[model samples]
Target: MVISTHKMVDCTSPVDAARLFNAFCIDNHNFMPKALPDFIKSVDVLHGESGTVGSIKQINYPEGRPYKYAKNRVDEIDVDKFYCKFTAEGDVILGNIEYAVYESTFEPLESGTHYTMVVHYHTKGDYVVKEDQVAVSKEHMKNMFDIASEYLVTNPQLYALKQ
Candidate 1:
């Protein structure tokens, strides 16, 4: 088995950290499909409660996409600190990859939110992850963040932080 790790720390969103965190890590099941209907079909909780640790979710993609669905299990989450960690498997990691672990952190900033993402890819047997695969994954992650940020910016009251 081979493991590859990638980290991206310079991403920033115009939305506030709490709101972005709510949309991405906590309420993604409701927010993602609504924000990007053509890309994401739906997110269903398969086990445990949504937004909680140990919960597993199945993210379904729209037709014509490369993959149909992917299952992700929430390994850790901290609402107060705006941190979350999850592991993705199933169709998303088919072929040479065993699974991929993702960790995200949203830090509040004066202008917006500073976002960071780390991904750990575990490959099957002696297979090594290619640069193109990592590039594609990073692009997908950035697109998701951009889409969600735009949606939240347009609808400010959607995921507003509570007092």
Candidate 2:
């Protein structure tokens, strides 16, 4: 299923948008309270380069109480337009997922900036044929976007330049 979420940030630059995403990814105490042990080993382009396309991030997941070791790959980075596409192929809730793209566009609004995050994904494996389950997936996506927007807006220090 494809889920498109629209939101506006009270800012005038893409740097602020990227800062929010980066802060959310790295700042565990605030953003990732549910997954405390989760640590990001490295976040860089896949092929030893940096740019918009082919940007990849390697996340390391050690064995936990009920969680198993896993790795996620995030590619298709677009710094100029402020977007990136991610595809995970491993022991994830949804297997064989493809085209899991997340694109964020920031435009200068009259008083602030408009930010939109679009996510396109589809389920795989045995659950793929269960067409009726699409609602559940869409709901999850909606919840994710809501949480993200809330975080970005509520935490002004993220893009405030000064701590």
Candidate 3:
């Protein structure tokens, strides 16, 4: 079975939006872990070097959390388009599904920017994925994006300079 979810968020500026999206693509170590310390314990580059395709980033959660770690591989990335795709390979991600793919895109808007996330869940044979499970996962996903958005908002000067 296959399940899909789509979410969209508005940001302050096009460059900031693209940078925020790129931050997740490359800043799990310095930005995400630092900005959202409560949820993410740390992000270690387990396999390949980060900031490039094929790199694997492992994220650790706090103790007593639902899952311990999630290992995601950078499946595809487009710098020009400000989009990225990751394949989640961990117990939490593949628990009720065969595998999961997370895709994020940052696009320019007239006044600000638009960020969209699409999650595709592939379930095991003869198995069904509950909505509640997907909801929780979606919330988890939202928290990450919210934190990154907050970071970009609070540090406007920094992102503005990058633009």
Candidate 4:
């Protein structure tokens, strides 16, 4: 087996950390599909309660996408700190990967939030994950974050109550 880790940092958002975290991490299951209908079909809890540690969620993608669905298990969550860690597997791994662990954080700044994500990919056998593959994954995540940020900016009251 081979393990590869990639870190993406300094992604800035003009939104508050709490609000952005609330929408992106805490309420993503409810908000993602609504924000990006063409990309995400739905997110359903398969085990445990939603938003809690040890919970498993199945994220379904729309038809014609490269992946059909992915299952993620929440490993850690700290609402106060706007941090979350989860392990993803299933179709999203594309067979070559056993699973991927993702850690994300949204830190408050003077004018916005500083976002970061670290992904640890465990590949099957001796297969090594390439940089370009990681780049594509990072780009997809960035696009999603940008869209979510734009949605929050447009509807300022959307996740304000969650904070």
Query: What would you estimate as the lDDT of candidate 1?
Result: 0.88
What digit string (tens of lDDT, one per residue) describes model 3 on residues 16-90?
555676567766667777778888889899788785789998889888787898888988888778788888878
lDDT per residue for candidate 2 within 88-156, as digits (tens), equals: 443433444533444545544454445554544554443232335445555544455455545556666
Query: Local error of candidate 2 at 105, Å?
Result: 4.8
The per-candidate count of clashes, in order, stands at 0, 2, 0, 0
Model 4 regions lying over 4 Å from their true place = 161-163
Off by over 4 Å in 1: none
Worst 10 residues of 1 by lDDT: 129-138
- Cα lDDT computed for each candidate against the true fold: 0.88, 0.43, 0.72, 0.88
Candidate 2 vs candidate 3: the lDDT winner is: 3
Question: lDDT tens string, model 1, 88-146?
Answer: 98886778889999999999999899999998889889988877667776787788778
Which pairs of residues have clashing backbones in candidate 3?
none
User: What's the best-to-worst order under TM-score?
Assistant: 1, 4, 3, 2
Regions of model 3 farther than 4 Å from truth = 1-15, 130-132, 157-163
